[model samples]
Target: MGIRMIHHICIQTEKYTESLDFYTRILGFEVVSETANFHNREYNTWLKIGDFMIELQTPKAGDKFNVWSSLNGGPVHMGFLVDSVEEEYERIVELGYKDFKVKNGKIVYEVEGESLFKIKAPEGTEIEIRDTDIK
Candidate 1:
Protein backbone atom coordinates (compact mmCIF):
# COMPACT_ATOMS: atom_id res chain seq x y z
CA MET A 1 0.00 0.00 0.00
CA GLY A 2 1.22 3.46 -0.83
CA ILE A 3 1.06 5.83 2.08
CA ARG A 4 -0.11 9.36 1.54
CA MET A 5 0.83 11.40 4.61
CA ILE A 6 0.83 11.24 8.36
CA HIS A 7 -2.62 11.65 9.85
CA HIS A 8 -1.79 12.56 13.46
CA ILE A 9 0.49 11.85 16.41
CA CYS A 10 -0.68 10.95 19.90
CA ILE A 11 1.20 12.11 22.98
CA GLN A 12 0.35 11.18 26.53
CA THR A 13 0.66 13.83 29.24
CA GLU A 14 0.50 13.64 33.00
CA LYS A 15 -1.59 16.77 33.09
CA TYR A 16 -3.83 17.49 30.17
CA THR A 17 -4.21 21.20 30.80
CA GLU A 18 -0.51 21.83 31.17
CA SER A 19 0.30 20.01 27.94
CA LEU A 20 -2.49 21.85 26.18
CA ASP A 21 -1.10 25.20 27.30
CA PHE A 22 2.43 24.36 26.23
CA TYR A 23 1.38 23.24 22.75
CA THR A 24 -1.01 26.10 22.24
CA ARG A 25 1.11 28.89 23.67
CA ILE A 26 4.67 27.83 22.99
CA LEU A 27 4.40 25.58 19.95
CA GLY A 28 1.60 27.59 18.33
CA PHE A 29 -1.00 24.87 17.85
CA GLU A 30 -4.71 25.53 17.64
CA VAL A 31 -7.24 23.21 19.20
CA VAL A 32 -9.48 21.55 16.68
CA SER A 33 -11.32 19.08 18.88
CA GLU A 34 -11.56 17.82 22.48
CA THR A 35 -13.35 15.01 24.25
CA ALA A 36 -13.34 12.97 27.40
CA ASN A 37 -13.84 9.23 27.33
CA PHE A 38 -16.01 8.58 30.32
CA HIS A 39 -16.07 4.83 29.87
CA ASN A 40 -12.29 4.64 29.68
CA ARG A 41 -11.73 7.51 32.10
CA GLU A 42 -9.42 9.24 29.69
CA TYR A 43 -9.21 12.71 28.18
CA ASN A 44 -8.06 13.79 24.76
CA THR A 45 -7.48 17.04 22.92
CA TRP A 46 -6.54 17.52 19.30
CA LEU A 47 -4.48 20.40 17.93
CA LYS A 48 -3.67 21.34 14.36
CA ILE A 49 -0.44 22.71 12.98
CA GLY A 50 -0.37 23.34 9.27
CA ASP A 51 -1.34 20.02 7.66
CA PHE A 52 -0.55 17.93 10.74
CA MET A 53 -2.48 17.24 13.91
CA ILE A 54 -1.25 16.48 17.44
CA GLU A 55 -3.45 14.44 19.73
CA LEU A 56 -2.79 14.83 23.45
CA GLN A 57 -4.23 12.30 25.83
CA THR A 58 -4.36 11.66 29.56
CA PRO A 59 -4.51 8.12 30.80
CA LYS A 60 -7.20 6.74 33.07
CA ALA A 61 -6.77 6.07 36.74
CA GLY A 62 -4.56 3.06 37.52
CA ASP A 63 -3.07 3.10 34.05
CA LYS A 64 0.56 2.00 34.16
CA PHE A 65 2.26 4.34 31.75
CA ASN A 66 4.74 7.14 31.46
CA VAL A 67 4.54 9.38 28.40
CA TRP A 68 8.16 10.54 28.46
CA SER A 69 9.63 7.09 28.64
CA SER A 70 7.44 5.72 25.87
CA LEU A 71 8.53 8.52 23.55
CA ASN A 72 12.19 7.65 23.79
CA GLY A 73 13.61 6.64 20.36
CA GLY A 74 10.26 6.64 18.65
CA PRO A 75 9.40 7.89 15.17
CA VAL A 76 7.48 10.80 16.58
CA HIS A 77 9.47 13.94 16.01
CA MET A 78 7.52 16.86 14.52
CA GLY A 79 9.27 19.40 12.33
CA PHE A 80 8.18 22.98 11.96
CA LEU A 81 8.97 25.01 8.87
CA VAL A 82 10.52 28.35 9.74
CA ASP A 83 11.94 31.29 7.88
CA SER A 84 15.09 31.67 9.95
CA VAL A 85 16.84 29.05 12.04
CA GLU A 86 18.71 31.55 14.19
CA GLU A 87 15.55 33.50 14.96
CA GLU A 88 13.64 30.41 15.95
CA TYR A 89 16.55 29.15 18.01
CA GLU A 90 16.74 32.45 19.85
CA ARG A 91 13.03 32.47 20.44
CA ILE A 92 13.10 28.99 21.91
CA VAL A 93 15.93 29.99 24.25
CA GLU A 94 14.09 33.13 25.35
CA LEU A 95 11.04 31.00 26.05
CA GLY A 96 13.17 29.04 28.57
CA TYR A 97 13.23 25.59 26.96
CA LYS A 98 16.55 23.81 27.38
CA ASP A 99 17.83 23.44 23.82
CA PHE A 100 20.78 21.81 22.07
CA LYS A 101 22.91 24.26 20.22
CA VAL A 102 24.53 23.90 16.78
CA LYS A 103 28.25 24.67 17.04
CA ASN A 104 29.91 26.90 14.41
CA GLY A 105 26.58 27.58 12.72
CA LYS A 106 26.16 24.03 11.61
CA ILE A 107 22.92 22.78 10.12
CA VAL A 108 21.39 19.55 11.33
CA TYR A 109 20.26 18.10 7.97
CA GLU A 110 20.35 19.32 4.41
CA VAL A 111 17.45 18.32 2.16
CA GLU A 112 17.31 19.84 -1.28
CA GLY A 113 18.32 23.42 -0.46
CA GLU A 114 16.96 23.75 3.08
CA SER A 115 18.74 24.17 6.39
CA LEU A 116 17.51 22.19 9.40
CA PHE A 117 17.58 23.01 13.09
CA LYS A 118 16.65 20.38 15.61
CA ILE A 119 15.27 21.23 19.04
CA LYS A 120 14.10 19.20 21.95
CA ALA A 121 10.70 19.39 23.53
CA PRO A 122 10.05 19.75 27.25
CA GLU A 123 9.88 15.97 27.39
CA GLY A 124 13.10 15.46 25.39
CA THR A 125 11.35 14.80 22.07
CA GLU A 126 13.43 15.98 19.14
CA ILE A 127 11.76 18.50 16.84
CA GLU A 128 13.30 19.44 13.53
CA ILE A 129 12.73 22.86 12.00
CA ARG A 130 13.44 23.47 8.34
CA ASP A 131 14.36 26.97 7.23
CA THR A 132 13.80 26.15 3.57
CA ASP A 133 11.66 23.95 1.40
CA ILE A 134 12.47 20.25 1.24
CA LYS A 135 12.64 19.07 -2.29
Candidate 2:
Protein backbone atom coordinates (compact mmCIF):
# COMPACT_ATOMS: atom_id res chain seq x y z
CA MET A 1 0.00 0.00 0.00
CA GLY A 2 2.97 2.28 -0.35
CA ILE A 3 2.08 3.72 -3.70
CA ARG A 4 3.58 7.11 -3.10
CA MET A 5 5.05 8.18 -6.44
CA ILE A 6 5.49 7.05 -10.02
CA HIS A 7 9.04 6.15 -10.87
CA HIS A 8 8.47 5.80 -14.61
CA ILE A 9 5.92 4.83 -17.25
CA CYS A 10 6.70 1.90 -19.56
CA ILE A 11 5.31 1.36 -23.06
CA GLN A 12 5.57 -1.93 -24.92
CA THR A 13 5.09 -1.81 -28.67
CA GLU A 14 5.89 -4.07 -31.58
CA LYS A 15 6.31 -0.95 -33.71
CA TYR A 16 9.09 0.37 -31.57
CA THR A 17 10.48 2.59 -34.34
CA GLU A 18 7.14 4.19 -35.02
CA SER A 19 6.31 4.60 -31.36
CA LEU A 20 9.67 6.15 -30.63
CA ASP A 21 9.30 8.62 -33.48
CA PHE A 22 5.78 9.49 -32.34
CA TYR A 23 6.96 10.26 -28.85
CA THR A 24 10.18 12.00 -29.77
CA ARG A 25 9.36 13.74 -33.06
CA ILE A 26 5.59 14.12 -32.99
CA LEU A 27 5.20 14.80 -29.26
CA GLY A 28 8.65 16.45 -28.93
CA PHE A 29 9.97 14.41 -26.05
CA GLU A 30 13.77 14.04 -25.84
CA VAL A 31 15.67 10.82 -25.59
CA VAL A 32 17.49 10.86 -22.28
CA SER A 33 18.88 7.35 -22.39
CA GLU A 34 18.94 4.11 -24.35
CA THR A 35 20.31 0.61 -23.95
CA ALA A 36 20.19 -2.84 -25.44
CA ASN A 37 18.04 -5.66 -24.09
CA PHE A 38 20.57 -8.43 -23.89
CA HIS A 39 18.03 -11.07 -23.03
CA ASN A 40 15.64 -10.37 -25.86
CA ARG A 41 18.21 -8.81 -28.21
CA GLU A 42 16.09 -5.74 -28.76
CA TYR A 43 16.34 -2.06 -27.97
CA ASN A 44 15.18 -0.24 -24.85
CA THR A 45 14.98 3.52 -24.79
CA TRP A 46 13.83 6.23 -22.43
CA LEU A 47 12.35 9.55 -23.38
CA LYS A 48 11.66 12.54 -21.19
CA ILE A 49 9.07 15.26 -21.42
CA GLY A 50 9.28 17.76 -18.58
CA ASP A 51 9.27 15.78 -15.34
CA PHE A 52 7.80 12.60 -16.77
CA MET A 53 9.83 9.71 -18.18
CA ILE A 54 8.62 7.01 -20.58
CA GLU A 55 10.23 3.67 -21.23
CA LEU A 56 9.74 2.31 -24.75
CA GLN A 57 10.40 -1.36 -25.16
CA THR A 58 10.14 -3.97 -27.91
CA PRO A 59 8.67 -7.44 -27.49
CA LYS A 60 10.88 -10.48 -27.83
CA ALA A 61 10.90 -12.12 -31.25
CA GLY A 62 11.31 -15.73 -32.32
CA ASP A 63 10.25 -16.75 -28.87
CA LYS A 64 8.58 -19.66 -27.19
CA PHE A 65 9.42 -18.52 -23.69
CA ASN A 66 7.15 -16.99 -21.10
CA VAL A 67 8.62 -13.52 -20.86
CA TRP A 68 6.45 -10.56 -19.98
CA SER A 69 6.73 -6.97 -18.93
CA SER A 70 6.19 -6.05 -15.29
CA LEU A 71 3.41 -3.82 -16.58
CA ASN A 72 1.47 -6.89 -17.76
CA GLY A 73 -1.60 -6.06 -15.69
CA GLY A 74 -2.40 -3.56 -18.45
CA PRO A 75 -1.08 -2.47 -21.83
CA VAL A 76 0.54 0.88 -22.51
CA HIS A 77 -1.57 4.01 -22.30
CA MET A 78 -0.17 7.53 -21.76
CA GLY A 79 -1.58 10.97 -20.93
CA PHE A 80 -0.34 14.28 -22.23
CA LEU A 81 -1.01 17.77 -20.96
CA VAL A 82 -2.02 20.41 -23.48
CA ASP A 83 -2.63 24.12 -23.36
CA SER A 84 -6.13 23.62 -24.75
CA VAL A 85 -7.92 20.30 -24.86
CA GLU A 86 -10.20 21.26 -27.72
CA GLU A 87 -7.38 22.69 -29.76
CA GLU A 88 -5.17 19.70 -29.22
CA TYR A 89 -8.05 17.41 -30.08
CA GLU A 90 -8.49 19.13 -33.41
CA ARG A 91 -4.79 19.13 -34.15
CA ILE A 92 -4.45 15.46 -33.34
CA VAL A 93 -7.34 14.61 -35.64
CA GLU A 94 -5.91 16.81 -38.36
CA LEU A 95 -2.67 14.89 -37.97
CA GLY A 96 -4.62 11.66 -38.70
CA TYR A 97 -4.99 10.35 -35.15
CA LYS A 98 -8.49 8.90 -34.74
CA ASP A 99 -10.97 7.64 -32.13
CA PHE A 100 -10.96 10.93 -30.26
CA LYS A 101 -13.70 11.25 -27.63
CA VAL A 102 -14.44 12.58 -24.17
CA LYS A 103 -17.16 10.20 -22.92
CA ASN A 104 -15.76 7.95 -20.24
CA GLY A 105 -14.83 7.23 -16.61
CA LYS A 106 -11.33 8.59 -16.00
CA ILE A 107 -9.43 11.46 -14.45
CA VAL A 108 -11.69 14.47 -13.97
CA TYR A 109 -10.23 17.61 -15.46
CA GLU A 110 -10.80 20.86 -13.58
CA VAL A 111 -12.78 22.38 -16.40
CA GLU A 112 -16.37 22.68 -15.24
CA GLY A 113 -17.01 18.94 -14.73
CA GLU A 114 -15.50 17.79 -18.01
CA SER A 115 -13.22 14.77 -17.88
CA LEU A 116 -10.26 13.98 -20.14
CA PHE A 117 -10.51 12.82 -23.75
CA LYS A 118 -8.92 9.80 -25.40
CA ILE A 119 -7.25 9.09 -28.73
CA LYS A 120 -5.14 6.44 -30.41
CA ALA A 121 -1.58 6.80 -31.61
CA PRO A 122 -0.29 5.19 -34.81
CA GLU A 123 0.56 1.89 -33.16
CA GLY A 124 -2.88 1.49 -31.56
CA THR A 125 -1.90 2.89 -28.17
CA GLU A 126 -4.43 4.84 -26.15
CA ILE A 127 -3.38 8.41 -25.44
CA GLU A 128 -5.35 10.67 -23.14
CA ILE A 129 -5.04 14.39 -23.48
CA ARG A 130 -6.31 17.05 -21.11
CA ASP A 131 -5.99 20.75 -20.50
CA THR A 132 -3.05 22.06 -18.55
CA ASP A 133 -4.39 21.41 -15.08
CA ILE A 134 -2.18 20.01 -12.35
CA LYS A 135 -5.08 18.03 -10.94
Candidate 3:
Protein backbone atom coordinates (compact mmCIF):
# COMPACT_ATOMS: atom_id res chain seq x y z
CA MET A 1 0.00 0.00 0.00
CA GLY A 2 1.08 3.51 -0.68
CA ILE A 3 -0.06 6.86 0.59
CA ARG A 4 -0.33 10.02 -1.47
CA MET A 5 -0.64 13.71 -0.70
CA ILE A 6 -3.71 15.38 0.75
CA HIS A 7 -6.63 15.59 -1.65
CA HIS A 8 -8.55 18.35 0.04
CA ILE A 9 -9.50 19.99 3.32
CA CYS A 10 -13.13 20.69 4.04
CA ILE A 11 -14.22 23.73 6.00
CA GLN A 12 -17.75 24.55 7.12
CA THR A 13 -18.40 28.23 7.54
CA GLU A 14 -21.36 30.50 8.11
CA LYS A 15 -19.51 33.43 6.60
CA TYR A 16 -19.60 32.05 3.12
CA THR A 17 -18.78 35.20 1.19
CA GLU A 18 -16.05 36.25 3.60
CA SER A 19 -14.43 32.83 3.59
CA LEU A 20 -14.59 32.72 -0.20
CA ASP A 21 -12.91 36.09 -0.41
CA PHE A 22 -10.24 35.07 2.06
CA TYR A 23 -9.31 31.93 0.18
CA THR A 24 -9.66 33.28 -3.35
CA ARG A 25 -8.55 36.91 -3.10
CA ILE A 26 -6.12 36.91 -0.22
CA LEU A 27 -4.72 33.40 -0.30
CA GLY A 28 -4.80 33.08 -4.10
CA PHE A 29 -6.64 29.79 -4.38
CA GLU A 30 -8.35 29.55 -7.72
CA VAL A 31 -11.96 28.47 -7.78
CA VAL A 32 -12.35 25.14 -9.44
CA SER A 33 -16.08 24.95 -9.05
CA GLU A 34 -18.80 26.70 -7.06
CA THR A 35 -22.25 25.21 -6.78
CA ALA A 36 -25.18 26.73 -5.01
CA ASN A 37 -27.34 24.38 -2.92
CA PHE A 38 -25.10 21.42 -3.36
CA HIS A 39 -25.87 18.34 -1.29
CA ASN A 40 -27.91 20.18 1.33
CA ARG A 41 -25.48 23.05 1.61
CA GLU A 42 -26.20 26.62 0.77
CA TYR A 43 -22.96 26.64 -1.18
CA ASN A 44 -20.23 24.17 -1.94
CA THR A 45 -17.09 25.65 -3.38
CA TRP A 46 -13.99 23.85 -4.49
CA LEU A 47 -10.85 25.95 -4.54
CA LYS A 48 -7.50 24.75 -5.73
CA ILE A 49 -3.86 25.73 -5.52
CA GLY A 50 -1.35 23.54 -7.26
CA ASP A 51 -2.40 19.99 -6.48
CA PHE A 52 -4.32 20.71 -3.28
CA MET A 53 -7.94 21.68 -3.01
CA ILE A 54 -10.05 23.36 -0.33
CA GLU A 55 -13.65 22.29 -0.06
CA LEU A 56 -15.66 25.11 1.46
CA GLN A 57 -19.29 24.57 2.29
CA THR A 58 -22.04 26.55 3.92
CA PRO A 59 -24.51 24.61 5.99
CA LYS A 60 -28.26 24.92 5.67
CA ALA A 61 -29.94 27.56 7.77
CA GLY A 62 -30.51 26.78 11.44
CA ASP A 63 -27.91 24.08 11.47
CA LYS A 64 -26.24 23.62 14.84
CA PHE A 65 -22.67 23.34 13.58
CA ASN A 66 -23.08 26.10 11.06
CA VAL A 67 -20.97 28.43 13.12
CA TRP A 68 -17.23 28.12 13.57
CA SER A 69 -16.78 25.84 16.58
CA SER A 70 -14.38 23.08 17.38
CA LEU A 71 -15.68 19.60 16.65
CA ASN A 72 -14.07 18.22 19.82
CA GLY A 73 -11.77 15.77 18.08
CA GLY A 74 -11.82 17.14 14.61
CA PRO A 75 -8.86 18.93 13.12
CA VAL A 76 -7.42 21.51 15.46
CA HIS A 77 -6.18 23.65 12.59
CA MET A 78 -4.78 23.62 9.07
CA GLY A 79 -1.45 24.66 7.58
CA PHE A 80 0.10 25.54 4.25
CA LEU A 81 3.68 25.14 3.19
CA VAL A 82 5.12 28.22 1.56
CA ASP A 83 8.42 29.13 -0.03
CA SER A 84 9.19 31.93 2.42
CA VAL A 85 7.26 32.40 5.64
CA GLU A 86 8.56 35.93 5.98
CA GLU A 87 7.28 36.99 2.58
CA GLU A 88 3.88 35.43 3.16
CA TYR A 89 3.66 37.06 6.57
CA GLU A 90 4.41 40.47 5.11
CA ARG A 91 1.87 39.99 2.31
CA ILE A 92 -0.85 39.03 4.75
CA VAL A 93 -0.06 42.03 6.91
CA GLU A 94 -0.18 44.28 3.86
CA LEU A 95 -3.71 43.04 3.21
CA GLY A 96 -4.79 44.76 6.44
CA TYR A 97 -5.09 41.58 8.46
CA LYS A 98 -4.24 41.74 12.17
CA ASP A 99 -4.99 38.24 13.40
CA PHE A 100 -1.41 37.10 13.71
CA LYS A 101 0.62 36.70 16.88
CA VAL A 102 3.34 39.26 17.34
CA LYS A 103 6.27 39.48 19.68
CA ASN A 104 8.92 42.18 19.54
CA GLY A 105 7.14 43.71 16.56
CA LYS A 106 7.57 40.53 14.55
CA ILE A 107 4.76 38.47 13.14
CA VAL A 108 6.85 35.43 12.28
CA TYR A 109 7.53 33.10 15.18
CA GLU A 110 10.41 30.73 15.51
CA VAL A 111 10.02 27.22 16.85
CA GLU A 112 13.16 25.13 17.22
CA GLY A 113 14.85 27.37 14.62
CA GLU A 114 12.07 26.96 12.09
CA SER A 115 10.47 30.04 10.55
CA LEU A 116 6.69 29.96 10.62
CA PHE A 117 3.62 31.95 11.52
CA LYS A 118 -0.10 31.60 12.12
CA ILE A 119 -3.00 33.64 10.86
CA LYS A 120 -6.65 33.24 11.79
CA ALA A 121 -8.95 32.34 8.94
CA PRO A 122 -12.12 34.31 8.53
CA GLU A 123 -14.00 31.61 10.41
CA GLY A 124 -11.49 31.60 13.27
CA THR A 125 -9.50 28.60 12.12
CA GLU A 126 -5.77 28.97 12.69
CA ILE A 127 -3.89 28.65 9.42
CA GLU A 128 -0.20 28.02 9.92
CA ILE A 129 2.30 29.19 7.35
CA ARG A 130 5.59 27.30 7.34
CA ASP A 131 8.78 27.48 5.36
CA THR A 132 8.92 24.88 2.63
CA ASP A 133 12.48 23.82 3.35
CA ILE A 134 11.95 23.35 7.09
CA LYS A 135 12.94 20.00 8.43
Candidate 4:
Protein backbone atom coordinates (compact mmCIF):
# COMPACT_ATOMS: atom_id res chain seq x y z
CA MET A 1 0.00 0.00 0.00
CA GLY A 2 1.06 3.55 -0.73
CA ILE A 3 0.69 6.44 1.61
CA ARG A 4 -1.23 9.57 0.70
CA MET A 5 -2.35 12.88 2.14
CA ILE A 6 -4.89 12.95 4.91
CA HIS A 7 -8.41 12.61 3.56
CA HIS A 8 -10.08 13.68 6.76
CA ILE A 9 -9.85 13.89 10.50
CA CYS A 10 -12.55 12.77 12.92
CA ILE A 11 -13.21 14.61 16.17
CA GLN A 12 -15.77 13.86 18.82
CA THR A 13 -17.56 16.78 20.41
CA GLU A 14 -20.05 16.96 23.22
CA LYS A 15 -20.99 20.39 21.94
CA TYR A 16 -21.73 19.66 18.31
CA THR A 17 -23.38 22.97 17.50
CA GLU A 18 -20.56 24.95 19.08
CA SER A 19 -17.95 22.97 17.19
CA LEU A 20 -19.85 23.41 13.94
CA ASP A 21 -20.04 27.15 14.39
CA PHE A 22 -16.38 27.36 15.28
CA TYR A 23 -15.35 25.55 12.10
CA THR A 24 -17.81 27.30 9.83
CA ARG A 25 -17.71 30.83 11.16
CA ILE A 26 -14.41 31.17 12.99
CA LEU A 27 -12.21 28.94 10.86
CA GLY A 28 -13.99 29.54 7.53
CA PHE A 29 -14.95 25.93 6.80
CA GLU A 30 -18.08 24.75 5.04
CA VAL A 31 -20.27 21.75 5.68
CA VAL A 32 -19.97 19.18 2.95
CA SER A 33 -22.14 16.35 4.28
CA GLU A 34 -24.04 15.23 7.35
CA THR A 35 -25.57 11.92 8.38
CA ALA A 36 -27.31 10.39 11.36
CA ASN A 37 -26.77 6.76 12.20
CA PHE A 38 -29.96 5.36 13.67
CA HIS A 39 -28.49 2.03 14.58
CA ASN A 40 -25.52 3.55 16.29
CA ARG A 41 -27.49 6.51 17.50
CA GLU A 42 -24.83 9.02 16.50
CA TYR A 43 -24.58 12.12 14.33
CA ASN A 44 -21.75 12.91 11.96
CA THR A 45 -21.10 16.22 10.28
CA TRP A 46 -18.41 16.60 7.65
CA LEU A 47 -16.72 19.97 7.27
CA LYS A 48 -14.50 20.98 4.39
CA ILE A 49 -11.43 23.18 4.80
CA GLY A 50 -9.58 23.66 1.55
CA ASP A 51 -9.02 20.12 0.25
CA PHE A 52 -9.19 18.44 3.63
CA MET A 53 -12.28 17.56 5.60
CA ILE A 54 -13.09 17.12 9.28
CA GLU A 55 -15.73 14.81 10.67
CA LEU A 56 -17.50 15.93 13.80
CA GLN A 57 -19.29 13.16 15.60
CA THR A 58 -21.61 13.06 18.58
CA PRO A 59 -22.04 9.84 20.46
CA LYS A 60 -25.34 8.67 21.83
CA ALA A 61 -26.17 8.57 25.51
CA GLY A 62 -24.50 5.64 27.33
CA ASP A 63 -22.34 4.89 24.30
CA LYS A 64 -18.72 3.88 24.67
CA PHE A 65 -16.76 7.04 24.02
CA ASN A 66 -13.60 7.14 21.91
CA VAL A 67 -13.15 10.78 20.96
CA TRP A 68 -11.62 13.85 22.60
CA SER A 69 -12.75 14.75 26.06
CA SER A 70 -13.89 18.21 27.08
CA LEU A 71 -12.01 17.99 30.40
CA ASN A 72 -8.82 16.01 29.75
CA GLY A 73 -7.01 18.77 27.80
CA GLY A 74 -8.97 17.91 24.62
CA PRO A 75 -7.81 16.38 21.35
CA VAL A 76 -4.54 16.73 19.48
CA HIS A 77 -6.03 19.50 17.38
CA MET A 78 -5.84 19.99 13.58
CA GLY A 79 -3.68 22.01 11.18
CA PHE A 80 -4.84 24.26 8.39
CA LEU A 81 -2.75 25.81 5.61
CA VAL A 82 -3.16 29.45 4.84
CA ASP A 83 -1.93 31.73 2.12
CA SER A 84 -0.54 34.12 4.69
CA VAL A 85 -0.22 33.13 8.31
CA GLU A 86 -0.06 36.72 9.42
CA GLU A 87 -3.32 37.62 7.70
CA GLU A 88 -5.13 34.69 9.26
CA TYR A 89 -3.63 35.51 12.62
CA GLU A 90 -4.97 39.05 12.53
CA ARG A 91 -8.36 37.83 11.40
CA ILE A 92 -8.58 35.29 14.16
CA VAL A 93 -7.65 37.92 16.69
CA GLU A 94 -10.34 40.29 15.43
CA LEU A 95 -12.87 37.49 15.69
CA GLY A 96 -12.27 37.42 19.47
CA TYR A 97 -11.35 33.73 19.98
CA LYS A 98 -9.30 33.21 23.11
CA ASP A 99 -5.77 31.73 23.43
CA PHE A 100 -3.96 33.35 20.52
CA LYS A 101 -0.18 33.60 20.50
CA VAL A 102 2.88 33.58 18.24
CA LYS A 103 5.83 31.25 18.40
CA ASN A 104 9.14 30.85 16.58
CA GLY A 105 8.39 34.02 14.59
CA LYS A 106 5.43 32.28 12.88
CA ILE A 107 1.79 32.94 13.45
CA VAL A 108 0.32 29.96 15.24
CA TYR A 109 -3.34 29.31 15.88
CA GLU A 110 -2.78 25.98 17.64
CA VAL A 111 -0.10 24.05 19.48
CA GLU A 112 0.18 21.37 16.81
CA GLY A 113 2.58 23.37 14.66
CA GLU A 114 6.16 24.21 15.43
CA SER A 115 5.82 27.92 14.58
CA LEU A 116 3.53 30.84 15.47
CA PHE A 117 0.37 31.46 17.40
CA LYS A 118 -2.12 28.82 18.51
CA ILE A 119 -5.83 29.48 18.20
CA LYS A 120 -8.25 27.50 20.31
CA ALA A 121 -11.62 26.60 18.94
CA PRO A 122 -14.94 26.68 20.71
CA GLU A 123 -15.10 22.94 21.36
CA GLY A 124 -11.72 23.14 23.11
CA THR A 125 -10.02 21.90 19.92
CA GLU A 126 -7.11 23.94 18.61
CA ILE A 127 -6.70 24.84 14.91
CA GLU A 128 -3.15 25.51 13.82
CA ILE A 129 -2.80 27.71 10.77
CA ARG A 130 0.41 27.63 8.80
CA ASP A 131 1.76 29.12 5.60
CA THR A 132 1.76 26.25 3.16
CA ASP A 133 0.07 25.00 0.06
CA ILE A 134 -2.95 23.00 1.20
CA LYS A 135 -4.03 22.30 -2.34
> Tell me, what's the RMSD of every candidate?
3.9, 5.5, 2.4, 5.0
For model 1, the run of ten residues with the poorest summed lDDT: 101-110
User: Model 3, poorest ten-residue lDDT window?
Assistant: 64-73
Q: Please identify which of the two predictions, 1 or 3, would achieve the higher lDDT against the true structure.
A: 3
Expressed as tens digits, the lDDT of each residue in 3-116 for candidate 4 is 688888877777788888888988888999888883465678889977888888876767666444436654565667677877877787787765654455544433444334
The lDDT, on a scale of 0 to 1, for candidate 4 is 0.71
Q: Which stretches of candidate 4 lie over 4 Å from their true place?
A: 37-39, 63-75, 101-115, 132-135
16-131 per-residue lDDT for model 2 (tens digits):
78888778866778999878874584878889988788888776766433334336677556777788877766676676645543444433343566546776654566777777
Q: Can you tell me which runs of candidate 2 are displaced by over 4 Å?
A: 1-4, 64-76, 99-112, 132-135
**lDDT for model 1:** 0.71
- For each of the candidates, give the backbone clash count: 0, 0, 0, 12
Cα lDDT of model 1 by residue, 14-131, tens digit: 6677668767876789999888884475778889988899888777777866555424666756778888877877776687765653645664545565667776555445578777
TM-score of 2: 0.66
lDDT score, residue 116, model 2? 64
Tens digit per residue, CA lDDT, model 3, 1-135: 777888999888888898898888778999999999887789999999999999998877668563455565778777889889888988887987777756567778787888888777787777888986644
**How does residue 88 of candidate 1 score in lDDT?**
75
Query: Cα deviation of 32 in candidate 1 (Å)?
Result: 1.1
Arranged by lDDT, best first:
3, 1, 4, 2
lDDT of each: 0.71, 0.68, 0.83, 0.71
When 3 and 4 are scored with TM-score, the better candidate is 3
Task: Report model 4's TM-score to 2 decimal places.
Answer: 0.70
